[model samples]
Target chain A: MDTSVRSKGTLKLMIVDDSNIIRRRIERSQQIARLEVVGAASNGRAAVEMFRRTQPDVVTMDLTMPEMDGIECVEELIAINSEVLILVVSALADKATAVEAIEKGANGFLCKPFTDRQLNDALEELLSEA
Target chain B: MFKEAEIRTFIEGTTNYFETSAQQSATVGSPYLVTDGNPGAYEYTGVIGVTGARKGVVYFTAPRGMLTVLLMRMQETDTSDENIKDLVGEVANTISGNARRDFGKNFVISVPVVIAHDLEKVTTPHSRSFVIPINWRTHSAKLVVCLE
Candidate 1:
């Protein structure tokens, strides 16, 4: 638990998933007071572009996406902003996929079809690491 | 042909989707083979293409009314056609994605292709497909697994 990374105001959050409903769900399910969503994208390519523009502190990334999957996007985002914290939010339940995302620099993993409480808890844990 | 355990993985996945996402446990009746020409899809179908170790399509077809209620349960106010499509697609994606836990990484699934039309009339590539009946609340839907 490192509190030295962020000063603790409003954390800029980005949602990246191929499903529009998922993006909206994540947007509406925010219970944490510090998390303020900055932007969202449907694919990893757009996510990368948005990340560059908005420079969000945290990103909830989906693994299986259209252009440039999350694995590649994770690598790219880490290269640009090593300090950025990313949580792999995906339906890929295999352990291998989770390991791969973490290996590429994602901070945490939350599986799809998650409950609102589960989502908030994951985000809380993600930020606690910072 | 998939093993019984493999098919069970999908059944568990489908039921788990309802339990976790919808917050209600859906009843999945025993799966039966669709011998008739039609595989029997409802008003809205979310189709996902499978690749890697397996090749075929896995879809979840439900009615507009069912999806609308589902959206409402998820705290979504707008139940537009696009929203309905998104819900159906997400269901298909979640179910297929969860299967990877048992089927491993080779059971790769594609993003959903939502169909608002009647899939009951469409001809499927596979001669035989397994249809898993799902009942939630007063609504009924089908989870069709057509693999080769």
Candidate 2:
């Protein structure tokens, strides 16, 4: 695990979702003073490319997307940087899908239609675990 | 034909969306079936294709004014045409995705396909659509469920 996140000052974050509103909601709901959004991607293919370039310490991922889904993107992201914390932010409200995402490599799961407080709490939990 | 309980699943999902995301409750009127050409649609519509366990389209249609207000409720300042479309699509996606809890993982859903004042392309032949009326504040929207 990359423990240098605290030493690097602010933690770099990435937002990956197909919906522009969702991406923007996550971006605008950033209440963590130490967390800074580094990049945002619409699809998994674009997310993979952005992950390579930005190397975000954390990522908020959505499962159902156009080109590449969140599951594949999570695997690729972990392969690139195993220490990167990922929280699956999806509307798919099924235990099987959530378990599948966790099995693949997501650190946590947050259902859609979440409040701002819920989002901040989830992100805080993900970072605390790391 | 879907059972009353099956349809209720979607109704709960719709009401839940407003309460959770928008931080306000939306009243759901009685659901009715529309087997004609196309059901009523507002200025903007977001369509999602369903496959796997079931096959059809699920859409959320709302007026431009309602969507603009919804965007504001979500704290989204950008109410451009593109953002409005995105907001409507997210609503449709969230409703359909929430149904996966009852439909299981086999109920596959596609990414949202936003439509602007066009309903002909979304009509499903030989299928009756269940229109669930959603009343939020002074605005009215519809969640059309067309599934096999």
Candidate 3:
């Protein structure tokens, strides 16, 4: 696991979702988790490319996107860097997919319409497990 | 035809989405079945197709006023037409996604299709649509579910 970014005191985060509203919401709520959003992507394809470029410490992913869904993105992200922490923040309510994501290397999963407090708590838990 | 449980699930999804995403509570009115056209015509609508174990369509319709307030509550200062359309689609997607928890993997929701006007003409015909009225912050919108 890459602890260098977390050890630096401020984690570099990336938000990936198809909806602009969702991406902006996560960006606005980053303060709750004390993280810096270094990058964002609207689709999985863009997310993969951005992940390679930004190499953020953590990534918030949304499933059911247009270009590339979250499941595929998670696989690609983990393949690229097994150390990177991926938190699935998606509107998908399927437990099967959530479990699949974990099996595919996602560190955590959170449903949509979450509060800032909930978001902060999830991030804290993910980081703690790291 | 739609099952009572299915309708209840959709209502819960709509309520949860509003409360969490917009920080606004929503009241769901009685659900009624409609067969010819949309229950109530609106300026904007977000439609999503459901496939897999069940085949159907779901949508969220709202007037410009309601959509504007929703956008503003979402921290969007620019309630432009484009933003309103985007907001509507996101709301519908969130609601449908939430329902998947109750419906299980059998419910597969597609990406949202946003309609700015003339929803009645494009709405699916023959299928029975359950129209549920939702009131939020004095503004009103409708959640329509049509299944095969």
> How good is model 1 by TM-score?
0.95
In order, the TM-score of chain B in each prediction is 0.94, 0.94, 0.92
TM-scores, in order shown?
Answer: 0.95, 0.96, 0.93
Candidate 1: where are CA atoms >4 Å away? A1-4, B120-123
**lDDT ranking, best first:** 2, 1, 3
Model 1, residue B62: displacement in angstroms? 0.3
lDDT of 2 by residue, B29-117 (tens): 99998888477688899989999988888999999999998899999999999999999999999999999999999999999999987
Q: What is the alpha-carbon lDDT of model 2 when measured against the actual structure?
A: 0.91
User: What fraction of native interface contacts is shared by candidate 3?
Assistant: 0.65
TM-score of 3: 0.93
Model 3: residues with Cα > 4 Å off, grouped in runs: A1-6, A32-34
Query: lDDT tens digits, residues A11-65, model 2?
Result: 9999999988889999999798889999999999999999999989999999999
A61-94 per-residue lDDT for model 1 (tens digits)? 9988888899999999999999999999999999
The TM-scores, chain A only, for the candidates as listed are 0.95, 0.95, 0.91
Query: How would you encode candidate 3's per-residue C-alpha lDDT over B1-148 as one tens digit per residue?
Result: 4576669988888889889877888999998988665566578989888998778788899999998888778777777787788888888888888888988877898989998877555476445688999998888889988877
DockQ, all models: 0.80, 0.87, 0.70
DockQ, candidate 1, comes to 0.80
